[model samples]
Target: MRFALLATTMLAGSALLASCATKEAPVPVTPAAVVEAPAPAPEPAKPAPQLGAFGFDEAGMDKGVSPGDSFYNYANGTWAKNTPIPSDRSNYGMFTVLADLSQKRTQGILEEVKANPNSKIGVAYSTYLDTGTIESKGLAPIQPWLNQVKGLKSKAGYAALLAQADRNGVSIPFGSYVGQDDKNPEVYALNLSQSGLGMPDRDYYLSADAKQVANRAAYEKHLTNVLTLAGEPNAAARAKAILAYETEIARVHWTRVDSRDATKTYNKMTLAELTKKAPGFDFGGYFTGIGAKVDYVLVSQPSAVTGIAKLIRSTPIAVLKDQLLVRSLDRFSAVLPDAFDKENFSFYGTTLSGTPEQQARWKRATDWTAGALEDEVSKIYVAKYYPPETKAVMDEMIKNIIAAMGRRIDALEWMSPETKVKAHAKLAAFTPKIGYPDRWRDYSDLNIVSGDALGNVIRANNWAHEENVNHLGKPLQRWEWGMTPMEVNAYANFGMVEIVFPAAILQPPFFDPNADPAVNYGGIGAVIGHELSHHFDDQGAKYDASGTLTDWWTPADVAAFKARTDALVAQYDLYEPLPGMHVKGALTLGENVGDLAGLTVAYDAYRHSLGGKAAPVIGGYSGDQRFYLGWAQVWRRNFREPAMRQRILTDPHSPSEYRAAVVRNLDPWYAAFAPEAGQKLFLQPDQRVRIW
Candidate 1:
């Protein structure tokens, strides 16, 4: 989704300035007959509520009724029955606002393309954005580029292609390629996940799990589709080619993860060692291509060294032809800013935090979002919006959530004793980053235009990129944060044992000092728990306690986790957004697991924090009920369908409605509040899946 990048701020007008850059419940408690009484009437099949109707006039009576409820029929009742998933989205949410705004902005830009109609950049973007033709065919504008890749016939052709990428400032190393880092050695990094492998991990390729076997079959099919789409005529031959190329890439990819943690411990390294370690692949040429000047390589995964050695030996020069894709990939990657801006305006500009005015003001305030932090504007912004009281509350909430999670971990009967220890250690290792950065990033070198919108943006991004690449060779800047202090998002990076909640998100619907602790705990506190739970989510559990990406869980624990997650995936996959569309549950399992765990742990923390205080009434419902309502209210939003479709294919998070509905459906505490028999939003005792 498009929006501003993490780090600094940009005014919407400033955003508009760079015309060229575009690139930017449950029932419970009551014994058997209470639950059975609700069972006889089929729960009245409450008609699904409209996305806008989720809120009630009361402060907390509208718990499950809030907008942005679950997308699934089972959870959302009548709302799912009547509401249709927009043709353009797989799921829907506040993101639709952002998407619509971007479309309008892009449409304005596109109108300029139509009016002036013929600059190189305009033509390029028009060709890329022509949805009528390209979207139907899955980015068909790249067909000619794909043909060029097909034409390569020899190792020399491959070398020439690599040289071209270097000339064009692209960086490709086996599986992924990034070109912008040519000037800053610290900027280069790869997102190890989402490499388009059907198998869960490299281990699946080498394992005997029946599911893995099926995944291999699916991988072959998926590769066949990609190759065919790329112009390969013979499915069988294309599958072989894709398999061979991917296997080699996976060899390198797997190695990088094998020892990522140890490598992150120290940043001192020589270029000679780096080159010697990963032979065949030309680091000097690659580094030169990206303009990176690293004192030491930031080996995020220590195991990357292992991959370097294996890639040096096992990879064949013949297989290198696939690297030709890197150039186009780099170009596409560059366009991410454009794509993101066009898609996620609401997410970045609205929901996460901030009004359009605030967002616009942010742009003007901390104009250099990417390059520097701790700017005067940022400090002021924090002081204005993120008060010390909120920060203190957040710190306490995190502690409570973590403690609650630990209590849950202690109760896991399925986990082995050894696995539990590792889990606990990982939990302990988690470093919570709340409010703003402890140390602001240095952006003195990045020159902001002050008024030259596009120039300022490019400079800021370039500076940030440089900072990232320079992390190589130097000690791991444990304090170097990834997200801006003012950003509205929160994140859990397993590699770093870090969880971040920026100041922008610490606001209404998430946290309110006057609100009951249950509500706050259910809202932002759950967000914290959700992030923390990532350490043990489906993909996260693969990583070991030290925050290294590894397989530390026992076979049984792994099986149980998957068994539960698989059900969740299937349940979500069945939710048809449009007539024929459904959410890809597997793609979203990691976040879903986090969502489930977050709500559970947050609720537990609330219960413990209450210290036996009676549930006070606020607005018509008890405080217990208000907590759920507060949680739902936070997600209250509406979306245009066109944008919703796009999110389903790309976003990992479920629609806001489903995000709330599913959690409430699984929340054991929800039933305690709304125990009215035969009411909708009540859950059967047998339906619950409590995995925290």
Candidate 2:
């Protein structure tokens, strides 16, 4: 959900992977979770309804609760208390509603494809849906790759195998891509990073915590069980060797906090220098085999690339090959036979995410179809669901929000005039990619056959690899989007100095054409402000408006800015979402700053929207109250304990409960609903942090 630079997940979509964490599979896909809503003042309320004017229900509020005390509870307490997470989903909330809507719509499109079979969308959708064929064929499809791994001997052969896997999309050993040059944002640069780990993160392998230690044992057993299922003769020994190899690789991995820092990680390297830096690895053959046409690459983790290469040279060829085999199995088990699916899900799903059951096959297959042919799927989706008028409205709102942020920057007291000038330029240069990309990804070369699910995926990955490689030395597609149109997510591409809100998020509680100006401003306005604030966050501040990663702040201004941010960090560090664990203030600083500043700017924009007129009360609440309620509705979420714990441990954003608590930073929120002391969320005037 952070800047989705060059990393690729299962569908090869744009992603921001943990620097050296297992890129192939993170703990589970991140789920939604909370913030600002109003408390009930002493008044006879109107007839309570299940939902409000739009889909954001006013009845979700717990009237008995106080706002300054716990706005999350006051706003979403009833919803949290009543909403049950779906059995198949580890977490559920506002995002899930939009996601389900998109999924259902996509399912209909795929179902049409299933009927047509000859159409382009149909061909892509049907590829992953031929489950009966998959179940009957069992491991026959991927067996060739496994057999190839079994016979791998020379280091060149191993490198070739890894490249082939990467090209074909079942890649396990570190991930590679071509992205914007951090130093020179206009040009495309190839990148390689640390990947190919069995567990979710390096901490799982190296942490001294007892729970993590036990999870490691379970992971090993899962690997052994999987290898044994694949008929490996010495499965137990191979598992041990594979674990040791991964552990060594993990040792050199960049920590999550360090990984989030763009300045520290972006290392431009020539192909020859890269070879020397990570000696013993055959990057030449790998690049040649993969058709990666580039002289230089943006190596995300130099130590990792070289360290894994060193591990490759020191470890026996068989063990290294076996690790590939195991990782391959883990990566593809979702589309493989039922046996593979059950085994893979048992650990990654049940043990890791704590969902009790797997989603139905159709849902999985449909989601795969959505991801696999997202360009085409998005095209169809836009034509059907997204209208031109909606885009026009979103564009207008984005412009308004930008104006609000610019006004805030012009008025900042801590930032020097020089820094403020740069900030204004950066904000003015901001490009809002609302709804979808101006240019679509070309999937023309990808061969999508009805029953060849594996073939379809491999070709899709190859298509992406080729596309990235071809971008070398070419001008950047500045208007290109990282997410598909149907995705229920938004991102701030710091390197591009742009903000993207996918078509899906533009609908519902996030943005509604029919909702009052206050509601729309509170929802999508906050999103716009959040992304805008990210530009001034610790990492984004390094990059100037032109998208170049250069310092634009005076030393004194930067120090003053950090001093304020440090207060924000310390405030969050005190939040205990789970017992015995605390939010990592340093890690989530950027996102926290985003939430805090975003809300502040959104509120300002809301008043600006009034054009100096009094805001009309709607739904028995005043305009300011409605604004806070709408903002809180944007974050409504419920998660299982396991998912909650996982999010706290790995996610850069604070927990949903804490995200809602971000209101404590703003004085206006306290003033709108005056709160006395002894409330759960009350903070002294000095305790509040202001960064904008």
Candidate 3:
């Protein structure tokens, strides 16, 4: 996956800027389930049968669904039909199963901590229990923050308020993160970008589509409920005013496409220069509050950030206070009272994401504790689940795949030799962080107590903020990790110029150690290829071997790459998940590039693994057939219609339906399935994209 570096705002993205993603978050909404959502997941007592190395998943397949018609359904049709999406989830598939398994282990750790709180896990566990006290406290926890907001009578104070909010990990007018300077790629620097919206994407405010209009209406009601609960006056009218402010902010934002371009967003300026360019907000005070030491900051989307200063200044003081109060309530409501929690779920869970019910409190608390004390929980997770052998095996697999990518780059006809030399240098320098970070993050300073739910989270957030910024003026910690061992996701860091596969993602169906080479190559093998390919994707390609965001490509090679990416974009744009709702081709171009490259290289590695011997037939499938199936099984998803529709609009990844279609771009897929003429998936040989 193209790793999105940690930023001040990861809250809402209608599209992904390559190399990053926000941890899952909920937005306020209404209770409008068109089709009744799935029921809560049933807990089975017995262990599931271990997937075999070579045995076919006969039950997983739909015999009648032809591979040529739709390979995703052909491989996963039976499972999709039989399995219901859990009531607490918007979608469920292979990844969800792995996540649920990891959650089960994480819960065991938290439950132990809850019973016996101590130095390491005590704070996170006690904070989890604090939610029980939230009802009795009854908005008292946020009263201090509310009073502070109300007292912000001057625009000068807005900057400080944002600084304070940043300590608690909340998004305000803008967000900042400590990352490598894109130009220097050696020392850590503070990066700021446009933010402060209550909605998930800027387009939610700008789009005239019916779904956006209805969801926006639901959001207005959601804002009203949250604000009214917080004891604010004129909740409905306040929501209207807030929406307009966000809409204007959205209008000025660099489009999602522009945001994805590294060359476009990397505008570095001195603090003094920034003040002159975007003069209303107090950078001097803001920098002081945040303890930023950098002489220069990278202002991503400068126009949008500058526009934010204008919005903050032009808006009335009362509206600004209301904005802070309402967003705070929306953000913290899940931990507040039953009413607040339920209301939060009504919209974000049901209306927007199509989850029918909220998860159990313990489950929700489990997530919070995990976030607050990730490394602490991960210490236990690694011991209980991830063995040393797994990491060793993963290391071997990564080497094979990287070697495969190296060969492909050497053979690229479109790339000039000059670009290939630099690309090769990058491949040689490519680092892989598998299983866990060499260094574990300390949460000693993050305060957590039994009764103060809000304070505990704020302190935790502050600890996180301080930890991130503390790296300033120091060498970049190349061994540092972005995601924890317990996180069931992978990332490719453009800053560190590395690929990370967390311990949790190392399990089957992504990586079945016991499975045959073909199976492993198809599943986790594709994921590894995907992350490596990200380094060469539109965004990652701009960065040099040292991780600087500098172009090393010859002009002729750059044009050829764009021509291919343009073709890839047009191919994906044709896929429509909902009426009039096609996936944003340009918005998802980087990810599409990664997906195409990852799967292609994975197939090549699998062939290389064969070492000239013909592939063996496993059950009824050939090696090639199982390879495609392995890839297909990874993306086997069952999504609620509304959730599917929303993801089509917002997620940088193409819909699961089309993610399976990534196989269509590969030549082996046609050869394996032999997609004949007139088949829905059939593409002429000349039309196939072979960019890897």
Which lDDT value does model 3 have at 72? 80
lDDT tens digits, residue span 586-666, model 2: 889999999998989999988988899998767677888888777888788998877876787788998877888888778
The estimated TM-scores of all candidates read: 0.57, 0.90, 0.91
Between which residue pairs do clashes occur in model 2? 35-660
lDDT per residue for candidate 1 within 477-570, as digits (tens), equals 6665566554557898666678998776775557656556666777788889899998778766766655555567889887887777877777
* Ranked candidates (TM-score, high to low): 3, 2, 1
Candidate 3 per-residue C-alpha lDDT over 1-692 given as tens digits, one digit per residue, 9 for 90 to 100: 12244334223324322432556564544445334434545554333325744523657888698877888889888988999999889999888888888888888887766756465465556565665678888887778887988888788788888788777776787879988888888877888898877777787788888888998899889988888877777889998988888788888877778887898888989999899888789987788788787799899999998998888888887887787877777678766777888888898889888899888877777788888888888888888888788887888888989999999998999998888999999999989998997777766666677667777777877888888889998876787788888888898998778999999898887876557678789888999999999999989999889888876999998899988998889898898878888888998988889889998888888899899999888776889988888888888788998888778767788887688888887777888888887877777888877787
The deviation in Å at residue 130 for candidate 1 is 28
Runs with alpha carbons beyond 4 Å of true place in candidate 3:
1-49, 52-56
lDDT of 1 at 323: 39
Candidate 1 lDDT score relative to the true structure? 0.53
By descending lDDT, how would the candidates be arranged?
2, 3, 1
- Cα displacement (Å) at residue 378, model 3: 0.9
